[model samples]
Target: MSLRIVPVSFHEACSFVDEWHRHHRAPQGHKFSIGAANEADELVGVAIIGRPVARPLDDRLTLEVTRMATNGTPNACSLLYGAAWRAAKALGYRRLVTYLQAEESGVSLRAVQWKIVAHLPPRRGWSTGCRPRTARGTDNVARTRWEARIAT
Candidate 1:
């Protein structure tokens, strides 16, 4: 089935991710969100772009794909990834990044020309002794960071 990129609200995207994402819970917030809709106008997937969670990369010009979830729709993810980069560039951002669990084959990202930039080893959960946070089961899982340059 063909898919078209469309605007999505943060709440709407979060709902979809909460129901569909395999490895992640819904994100806390986002700069923007995009959706993929099939010919029937039903949402098949969503991408949430937000400020980088990593402090060093949280500059004004960089954004991250904080969450992307789909109902196993073919090409829906690649469509959202490509659309997110184009939208970011149009809004003057310089780069966009995303992370995938090591177990995932990043075929969708590669389909859109996103390059793997780093292989991050598993780490302790985000919680610190002083700043305790809830465990989301993401700790101790290796991740691959991918990036794409926004066209000038």
Candidate 2:
């Protein structure tokens, strides 16, 4: 299917966030999200980012990309990540962050131009604890982190 990143309005975001929480309820809790829309304008993927309310000691806003998903194809995740990075940059965020699960081995996070900052701690409950009751597949998970600097 055709995939594109679009600006989700406040009301639209609310609905998507609600649906996301229903599916994935990880430990730190869900945060604002940038969404991926298909040809039919249906939300097929989401990249949730944690924008810290208070700036930490680093002075750079730590944007924790709490989640990423696709309707089926893994390619969808890269595009969604690109979209979220662009969005976060435009919003004055200094950096973008995300973690891949422990068992998701086949889940490829390496994109041609994206940077791999570190190997993060394995996420505890992406599929079992917070994933949607209907979600399937769990072997490709792993502890991974991806980051992009938004500003100099």
Candidate 1 regions exceeding 4 Å error are: none
- Cα lDDT over the full model 1: 0.95
> Model 2 clash tally?
13
Error of 1 at 30 (Å): 0.9
For this target, which candidate reaches the highest lDDT against the unseen true structure? 1
lDDT by residue for model 2 (1-152), tens: 67788665444554554555434443244446667778888787666666532245235565766656556544667787777777777877777776555444423445624566667553443345554444334333456556677546
Candidate 1 lDDT over residue span 26-103, tens digit each: 888899999999999999999999999999998899999999999999999999999999999999999999999999
Per-residue error (Å), model 1, residue 148: 0.4
Q: Candidate 2, after superposition: displacement of residue 148 in Å?
A: 1.3
Q: Which candidate is the best by TM-score?
A: 1
Model 2: per-residue Cα lDDT at residue 14: 49
TM-score of each: 0.96, 0.61
lDDT of every predicted structure (CA atoms): 0.95, 0.59
The Cα error of candidate 1 at residue 77, in Å, is 0.5
